[model samples]
Target: MWNRLFNKKSSVQRKILVSFLGLIIFPLGLFSYASMSVSKETIRKKEISSSLKTLELIADKLNIMASDLTAISNLYFANSSLYDLLKPPQGLGIYEENAKKDFLIKTMINYKYAYTWMDYNTTLFGKNGFELHTYYEGRKIGLDSIKNEPWYAEVVKANSGIVWVSDPSPKLIPTVDDDHFVSAVRILKDFESGTMLGIFLISVSESFLYKQYGNAVQDYEQVLLIDDKGIVISAPDKKMIGQAISSFGERTNKLADESGHFTTKVNKRNMLITYDSVGKTGWKIIAYTPLKELYADIGKIERLTILLFLSVLAISILVSYFIARRLSIPIQRLFTSMKKVEMGNLSERSDVTGEDEIGELARKFNRMVSRIEDLRDRVSAEQEMKRKTEFRALQSQINTHFLYNTLASIRSMLMIDPPEKVDAIIVALVRLLKKTLTEKGEFIPIAEEMDNLRNYIRIQEARQHEHLRVVFEVDEQIMHLKTLKLLLQPIVENAIFHGIEPKPTPGTVLIQGELSDNKVWFRIRDDGVGYSGFPPSDTELDITELVLEQSAGMGLRNIRDRIRLHYGAGGELSVISRSEGGTDVVLSIPAIMDPEELKL
Candidate 1:
């Protein structure tokens, strides 16, 4: 099917149109594809860079909040009054212990109200079995419940420094209504002995962390604060907190790097993951953005590219159509004219004209048609003249009256002259009959033509009542040259019948032949009435007029036509009437001795 479509023959216009479309479409398509690829890549990189910057900003904000929490936790270390209440009671009674616990609770409540914007809860655990909470309506617990917990060991390892914990068990770290919270825990120690004392836990609601970076989150995006253990510490979705970060995706393993981005699938949706370290926390600020969202602008660019490509293709088709028509129309005209010429309409011509090659061809075609038409007319006329000339030549050769007159003249001569003279006349008559009646080739040697002419002259002289003096001066060098048979006989016949026969006195006919200019020429003259019934003296005669108009019974025009038709430009005939009262006819023909020259 492909071959059938492609291999079929197509017109010039269709081919040109297709070629133009190909030229435009191929490059345009390549450029569009390249541009789209570049644009997509550029947008992706820019989004990645921008996403990384957002993560960094969120990390900075989280770092500031962590610092503030650490500073607030440090405040109790400097408070001697809170320290006195937290100290172990050496000899106090049950009521006194209760009274001291009440005093510590009141002090923590006052401190909590001091920084209401912080909205934090406090938990104090003594190295002894005592514990107190400034949250959950003053709920009290014992430190024995958290003594074996993993975070309890972290707080002791931290010594006087702060330890950040997120979403701890309510039994280990108390909170209101089992709500999620992040806490800063630190050990309280005596400044003088550097000896460990009770533990101080400062807890803030999870909303504190969320509010720090919540505005940076988007609908198709996720933001997570992941701890060093790959645990999600804080997130907009409260349930995700305290879960291993790997629960989001296996690609979370990449978060081990300090900073960078990678692509992954999260919840069956492709996503671009960007992450950065939060200062001093061993935690990461990880942002998960859907791949589609990161490259959203690329979709718009792709649509625009398709539209532009279609527009270019449409314009190219239109332009190609116009150009094809402009180029093919003239050639189509020329083709139409050619078909007419092929069908024998020689008058047909292309009318297109301009400076282009097609126009030049059209002009040449017009001239060619004109030339062909003229040649056809000339050939048609020549054919008619040749038919008439052949018939006249046959009639002249077979005239019974001329034969009877010749025989009668012989009989009269037999009575008046000697037998030898009579025999000579009879021999001339027999030779003339043999030469005229024989079927022979079109060309004969000059010597043979001259012999036949002598035979004809003898018969004419015998038939005429006047004395006829005919002279021959033929050159030996041209005697064997080839010429059309009976060429000279008709001219000599005209000189006798038309030039001398009507004269008051018998005239002499002079016949001369010689080689000139590599050709054979003959001169036939008669000293009798010159230009009496012909065109004026020395007036040039066209071959057509001489053959068709001047070809009376004399046959002078027939001889000229035969010469011209045989030799083309190599042969010529001219007539001149002299002041001395005689007519001269000069005939020139190619000196062709070889048969091969005939083909040329």
Candidate 2:
């Protein structure tokens, strides 16, 4: 059922389907990954914190043990019997070597301490050097090396206070890797001054440390011991107990604090190592938890989370199929209407049936299409009107293209005749063509338009021996004002064809323009028969304004139309005439024409 509703039958609907599916799949997958990562990290942190705490507790016990050893050493150093023996025994203090050894061994056995120390009573050392005693248990005094042994020299140097190491050592005791060990040494003190007189030593087995730690395993995760030099004195890795550790790149000493966790490699195993040091001894207790084990349980939780996420996503996909199909029904209808609009049917529109955002978009889309169709119709009508105007203008257009061909034909006519009249026609045509076709622009300076009038005079001279004469007039700015192409040419043509051509004698024709009151006034005047083969004036042009205006429009109608299209109605025209004498016409057009509007 789901597959049939949201199939690949249409790509647009399929995109909607895929969008809904992503809403389920991607977020669930991301949440699963995040939850798993947090779970794994939390577990690792708990393990490391627990291990550091265990190490701190072990260090606390070591502090107590070291204190007790100090107290014992202090007490023995102040003992009067041992202190008096530091000088001369006086009587009982003097003794034989073998006998002295046997007596001290008995004292040790009674005390049951690991070992005891004593220096020779010099006054009592009558015949031999200083005597030494190495005693254990109650009376087991064995061979002594007072002169060469390191422990014997250390006690004498310490002279008074206690010195004990809370560390693991394999030197004198038999024990497994986990067994803990320590030692103590001190100097005998004078009974009166409490000054050191001799030295004593003791070595305790790991049994004392074992009892201290009894069930420390569960209380804390790990425990270790570090000495004054930052060496690992007590640790699970037995080999590292004696070997020193250097910082990777530090120039100075690197020591663990009171308690904290750090990474270190021991026995080629990278571990989370936590340690705390015994205050006075400088020895530390260290514990390590393998990061791999801590992460192991967390990994299982992560896998389960991912599985749950996949199951949820699978169910969500099933639900989304229906939701996507329901949502896409309206969008499918919108696309159908849009296709109809694309195929030359602008009247087609979407039927929006809801007030949701998507429905609003469809309604707006339909309105936009309606507006576009309206604009297209308006543009089509405007183009049709413009085509008629251009065609009519082109029918009467005799300017640049017309003159070029006429002059080229006239040049050929000159070659065949070789007469003065032909030569004059050739010269007149050359001047005429230049004046009409300007290199600068379609709108030329009045000076250039006047140049065309001179050519017209020359052509008439050759054709009818100067039947008419002309004059020009203008202002400085008006001379440069842009006017339409061949504006004067047609005015001159009308005067010659209707006015001067029928005259019995020569006549006057004038062409000129002037700037006045921010506008330009152009005039063409002639003394001739006016209209319809009559005298100088006629009723066919009875309204001077009508003849001048219409002729101005016909002569400059395109120009006025182009100007009105470009500028406005303020562009005007006028005409004046008498039946026999002449006619005058003027164009009141914009003088300050925009150069951009004047571009060809």
- Best candidate per TM-score, number? 1
CA lDDT of each candidate?
0.76, 0.58
How far does residue 429 in candidate 2 sit from its true spot (Å)?
Answer: 50
Q: What TM-score should be assigned to candidate 1?
A: 0.57
What is the Cα-based lDDT of residue 513 in candidate 1?
A: 96
lDDT of 2 by residue, 357-396 (tens): 8799899989988998998899878865784466345424
Looking at model 2, residue 376 earns an lDDT score of: 80
lDDT by residue for model 1 over 1-600, one digit each (tens)? 434333557667877787788789999999999988898788778878988999889888777767767777777777664555556666456787787678777877877777766667877777655676776545556677667767878888877888877765577444534467777888887676676768888887777777778888677788888777788878888889888887666555677678999888888988888899987677898888887876687888888889989998988899999999999999888999999999999989898988999999999999999999999999989986885577456446534534765787788887777888778888997987677656665677888988988887876776564568899999999988888777787778777767887888888999999998898889998997654466444553423344336534346666655666666688888776665577788888889986469546
RMSD of each: 15.7, 16.4
Candidate 2 RMSD computed on C-alpha atoms after optimal superposition onto the true structure: 16.4
lDDT agreement of model 1 with the native: 0.76
lDDT leader: 1
Candidate 1 ranges beyond 4 A from true positions? 1-9, 34-42, 80-103, 172-178, 190-195, 250-253, 336-348, 366-600
